[model samples]
Target: MAEFLQFAFSGLTVGAVYALVALGFTLIYNASDVVNFAQGDFVMIGGMSTVFLYATGVPLPLAAIIAILTAVIVGLLLHRLAIEPARGASPVTLIIITIGASMFIRGVAQIVFDKQFHQLPAFSGDRPIEILGATLLPQSLWVLGGGLAVFVALWLFLERTLIGKAVLATAANRLGARLVGINTAVILAIAFGVSASIGALAGVLATPITLTRFDLGTIMTLKGFAAAMLGGMGSPLGAVVGGLLLGLIEAFGAGYISSVYKDGFSFIAILVVLFVMPRGLFGGRSVERV
Candidate 1:
C-alpha cells in the first residue's frame, strides 16, 4: 500500500505539470483554433529566464514574474507575426507554422541559455512529509496546489468575466462574434498571452523538481499534446483529467514495469485513446449540416 501511495504521489506531481501544459494547448485551440505547438517553449522560457535572472541577483519571486511576462510577450509576438499574418490559411498550414515557430523558439533558447540542464531552489525547502508509509515533497504540494488554483481561476475567468464570455463567443463562432462587435483579434491575442503565462507558470513551479534544459520543450510539447487529445482536445476539464490519467499511467508503469520504457507508456496511452475513444473522456460529439 505504501508503495502504491508513493507512485500515486509521484504521478500527481508530474501530472500537475502536464495538466498546465495541456491547459495552454486547450486555451489557444479554443480561442484561435490553432494548436500552438510552441506552447512548451513558454515553459522553457519561464524556467531558463528565471534561472538566469535570479543568478544575476534578481529576487526569485520577481524573476519568476518577469519570466512569465517575457513569455506573454513572446506569445503575443507569435500571434501578431506568424498566426495573424497567416489568417485564412489551411489548418495544416497553420499547424506547420506553429511547428516552425517551435523550432525557432528552441533555437533561440539554445543560444540564450546554453546547453546545460538547470535547477531552481525549492520554494519551500527540501522537506519530505510522510503519509501512510509514503513520502511527499513540499514542492509536490506546491505543484498540486498551483494546478488546482489555476484550474479554478481559469474556470472563473471563462464563466464569469465579460472578457471571458467574449472569448467563449469568439470560439463558438468567429463570424458571429465579429458581427456582434467583438474584437476577435484582441481575443486571440489574449488567449495566446494567457496560454503562454500558464505554461511559464508551470515551468517556474516544476523546474525545481524536474530540472530543465533548453531542449526539454520538445518532449513536453508531445506529452502535452497527447494529454490534450486524450482529454478531448477542446475541453478544459478533459485536459486536466487526461493529464492526470496519463501521469498516473506513467508512474505505475515505471514503478511496476521498467523505468526504461516509462516514456513509451504515454505514447501507448495516446494510441489507445486514438483507437478506442477518439473524442476523449470529456469531448462532445461533433455534428455538421450538409
Candidate 2:
C-alpha cells in the first residue's frame, strides 16, 4: 500500500506536467484546427532560458517569469512568421510546417544551450514530506499545485470573460465567428501565447525533477499528444483526465513492471484506447446534416 501510494504521488506530479502540455495542444487545436507540433519546444524554451538566465545571477522567480514570457514571444513569432504566412493551407501542410519549426527550434537550442542537461532548484527545499506512509518531494507539490492553478484560472477565463467567449465562438464556427465580428486572427495569436505560456510553466515546474535537455521536446510532444488524444483533442478537461491516466499507467507499469520499457506503456495505452474508441475517451461523435 505504501509503495502504491508512492507511485501514485509520483504519477500525479508527472501527470500534472503532461496535463499542462496537453492543455497547450488543446488550446491551439481548438483555436486554429492546427496542431502545433512545436508546442513541446515552448517547454524546452522555458527550462533552458531559465537555466541560462539563472546562471547569470537572475533571481529564480524572476528568471522563471522571464522564461515564460520569452516562450510567449517565440510563440507569437512562430504564428506571424510561419503559421500566419501559410494561412488557408491544408492542415497536413501546417502540421509539416510545425514539425519543421520544431526541428529548427531544437537545432537552435542545441547551438545556444548545448547538449548538456540542466535543472533548476526547487521552489522550496529538496526535502521530502511524508504522506500516508509515502515520501513526496516538495517540488512535486509545486508541480501539482501549479497544474491545478492553471486549470482553474483557465476555466475561469474561458467561462467568464467576453474575450474568452469570442475565442470559443471562433473555435465552434469560424465563419460564424467572423460574421459576428470576432477577430479570429487575434484569437489565434492569443491562443498561441496562452498555449506557450502554459507549456513553459510546465517545463519550469518539472525542470527540478526531470531536468532539461535540447532533445527533450520530442518526447514531451509525443506524451502530451498522446494524452490529448486519449482525452479527446480540443478538450481541456479531457487533457487533464487523459494526462493523469497516462501518468498513473506509467508509474505503476514502471513500479511493478520494467522501468526500461516504461515509456512504451503510453504507446500501448494509446493503441488500446484507439482500438476501443477511435475518437478517444471524451471525444464526441460526428454528426452530419444533409
Candidate 3:
C-alpha cells in the first residue's frame, strides 16, 4: 500500500505539470486552430529564464514573473510575425510553421541558456512529509495546488468575462464571431499569450522537481501532445484528465514494470489511443454532409 501510495503521489506531482502543458495546447488549438508545438518551449523559457535570472541576484518570485512575461512576449511575437502573416494558409502549412517556430525557439534557447541542466531551489524546502510510509515532497503540493488554481481561474475567466466569451465565440465559428463584432485577431493573440503564460507557469512549478535544460521542452511537447490527444484535443477538462491519467500510467509502469521503459509507456498509450479512439476519451464526434 505504501509503495502504491508513493507511486500515486509521484504520478500526481508530474501529472499536474502535464495538465498545465495540455491546457496550453487546448487553449491555443481552440482559438487559433493551430497546435503550437512550441508550447513546451515556453516551459523551457520559463524555467531557464528563472534559473538564469535568479543566479544573477534576482529574487526567485520576481524572476518567475519576469520569465512568464518573457514567454508571453515571445508568444505575441510568434503570432504577429509568423501566424498572423500566414493567416489564410492551410492547416498543414500552419502546423509546419509552428514546427519551424519550435525549432527556432529551441536554437535561440540553446544560444541564450547554454547546454546545461539546471534546477531551482524548492519554493518551500527539501523536507518531505510522510503519510502511511509514503513520502511527499512539499513542492508536489505546490504543483498540484498551482495546477488546480490555474484551472479554476481559467474557468472563471472563460465563463464570466466578456473577452472570454468573445474568445469562445471566435473558437466556435470565426466568420460568425466576426459578424458579431468580435475581434478574432485579438482573441487569437490573447490565446497565444495566455497559453504561453500557462506553459511558463508549469515550467516554474515543475523545474525544481524535474530539473531543466534548453532541450527539455522537446520531450515535454510530445508528452503534453499525447495527453491532449488522449483527453480530446479541444476539451479543457479532457486535457487535465488525460494528463493525470498519462502520469499515473507512467508512474505505475515505472514502479511495477521497469523504470527504463517509462517513457515508452506514454508512446504506447498514444498508439493505443490513436488506434482505438482517435477522437480521444472526451472528444465530441463530428459529422459531415456529403
lDDT of 1 by residue, 1-290 (tens): 99999999999999989999999998898887788899888989999999999999999999999999999999999999999999888768988999999999999998988999999999999989999999999999999998888888887888899998888888788899999999999999999999999999999999999999998889888888888999999888888988888899999999999999999998898888878887887886778676
lDDT of model 2 at position 204: 93
TM-score of each: 0.97, 0.97, 0.96
Task: Provide the overall lDDT of each model, using Cα atoms, as 2-decimal numbers.
Answer: 0.91, 0.91, 0.91
Candidate 3 deviant stretches above 4 angstroms: 285-290
Mind giving the per-residue lDDT tens digits that candidate 3 earns over 1-290? 99999999999899889989999998888786788899999999999999999999999999999999999999999999999999878868988998899999999998998999999999999899999999999999999998898888877877899998788778778899999888888999999999999999999999999999999889888889989999999888888888998898899999999999999997798789878888898886667576
lDDT of 2 by residue, 94-171 (tens): 999999999999999999888999989988999899998999999999999988999888878788998878877887
Instruction: Please report how far candidate 3 places residue 50 from its true position, in Å.
Output: 0.3
The TM-score of predicted model 3 comes to: 0.96
What TM-score would candidate 2 get against the native?
0.97
Model 2 residue 217 distance off true place after TM-score fit, in angstroms: 0.8
**RMSD to the native, candidate 2?**
1.2
**lDDT, residue 30, model 1:** 85
lDDT of 1 at 211: 91
